[model samples]
Target chain A: MASPLPQLQPEVAEKFRSTVIPCRIEMPRLGLTFDLRTLTLAEALELMKIPDFTYLVPRPKRRKAASSSTSK
Target chain B: MNTFSLTHLKGPQGDDNTPGLLGYVLVAREDAFSKIAKAPKTGTTAGETAIITDNHTFTNADDGFAKVYLTLDSNMLKAAITGERDGRGLKISFEGFHPGNNAEALEFMRIVKNLGLIILVPDADGTYLQVGAEGLPVEFAPDYDSGKLSSGRRGFTVKGEAYANGMYIYAGTVKYKA
Candidate 1:
C-alpha cells in the first residue's frame, strides 16, 4: 500500500538523515569521534508528524554557529 | 556599515497575540571554527552550543497590514541564541511573514521553541545577553525603543510597536549587501 504522505526528495532526504541527525560521527583527520544524539533531518521531520508541516530548504544565508539547540 | 532586515505577517486567523518572525544568521567574512572553539565560554547556561531561530507570522484577522518586520534580537531571539563572546562577527536578519496583523512579539519565540530552535540574546556593554533562567550569553542585540533609535532598516514600521529585533533587523539596507 502506497502511503499518502508526500515524499522528500532523495538527495534532500539523504542529507537530512545524515547531517541533521548523525548517530555516528568520525572526522578522521581531526581525530574526532563523537556519538551523536542529533536527529537526522528525516528524523526531525518524522518527529513533526503533522499533515500540514512543510520542509523548506532555506536559501543560502550567513553561516551559523556549529551546534543546534532547543529551548521551549 | 552593514544592514540586515526581515518582515513578519500573520497567517489566516491573524491575531495580534501571534506575531510572526523570520530570521537568518551570518558569520563574519573571515570567521573560522577555531575562533568559535576558542571563543569565551562565558555566557552560556544549560551547556548550549547551538542556536535556534524562527520565522514568525501573525495576523490581526482584520488588517492586511499590522505590525511588521523580521524579529530576532527581540526578547525571543535573545533567549534562543546564546554565547559568551562580546565581539563576534556573526549577524542575523528577519524576513517578513504573512497575515500582517495582531500578534505579540513573545509568542513568536514560543513558536521557534516548539519547532526545536533556540535564539541568542545580548547583554549590557553591547555584548551578547544571557537568560537568568539558564545563564547563557546570547548573540542578538538587546531590545530597546524603536523611535529613540532606528535599527537602520527602513521597511514598514508600525507605531506603538517599538522594539529592537537585532543587528540584522536594524540593518535593513545592508541585508542583501552583506
Candidate 2:
C-alpha cells in the first residue's frame, strides 16, 4: 500500500499529527478487529514531526485477506 | 444511568488558556466512590461487558465494560471535580508487536489509528462536557518473543482537574440488557 500522506494537503499533513486518524482494521484469522479511528501510541506522540516515523517501534503487519476480498 | 447536569467552572489561569491542567493522569475515580448498596448485576458471560439502557447500550468494545451512574447528587459532583483536582488525564490502550524485533517498519499512522479511544468527562456545576482531554488509563501489551517478553499494557493513576476534580466515571456491574 502507498503512503496516504500524498493525498493530504501540506497543512493537513502538519495537523495530521494532532487530529485523529480514522480506520478500522480486521484480522479474521485472529478474530481481531482494531478500531484505527481511535488514538494510538504514534498518534499520541505525533510521530509525523519525526523525519522517519519508523524511529518508533513497528507493530505487526495486518494479515492479508485469505480470499482477496475488498471488504472484510 | 450515570448522568450529571452541566455546570461551568473557572478554567485555570495561564498563557496556555486551556483549562489549567497539569497533565493527563489516569485516576481510578471509580475506586474512590462508595460501592453500590445493591450487588452489581453481572450480565451473561460475553467477551465484552455492556450496559443496555432504554435508549442506548454502552458496551466496552474490547475490554470488559462497566455501567456506572453519575447522578446530580452533591457527592457525585464532588467526585467529578476531584478528578480534575490533580490535573488533566486520559486513558490509553494498546496491543500488538514484539519489542525490538527488527521486522518491517510499523506504520505509526496505523498504530495511532488503531489504538485510541475517546472518553467524555462532564464538568461539575452542570455547564459543559469535557472529552478527549484528561488522561485516564492505557492498557497495552506487545507480542512476547521467546520469553523476551514485551510490556505495554499498563494503567495510569492520576488525579486532578483532568480526572478527579470534576469528573465522575461509571461504576458497578455493567448491564448487558436494559
- Model 1 off-target regions past 4 Å? A1-8, A11-16, A19-72, B1-106, B109-134, B139-178
Fnat of all models, as shown = 0.00, 0.00
Query: What would the per-residue lDDT of candidate 1 be over residues A1-72, giving only the tens digit for each residue?
Result: 753433344544544432122232222222333323433456445434633222233335556774665433
TM-scores for chain A over all candidates: 0.24, 0.26
In candidate 2, position B149 carries an lDDT of 41
Cα lDDT for residue B143, model 2? 29
Give me the displacement of residue B130 in model 2, in angstroms: 15
TM-score of chain B of 1: 0.19
Q: What is the fnat value (0 to 1) for candidate 1?
A: 0.00
lDDT of candidate 2 over B69-106, digit per residue (tens):
22222111112222254664433221222223233223
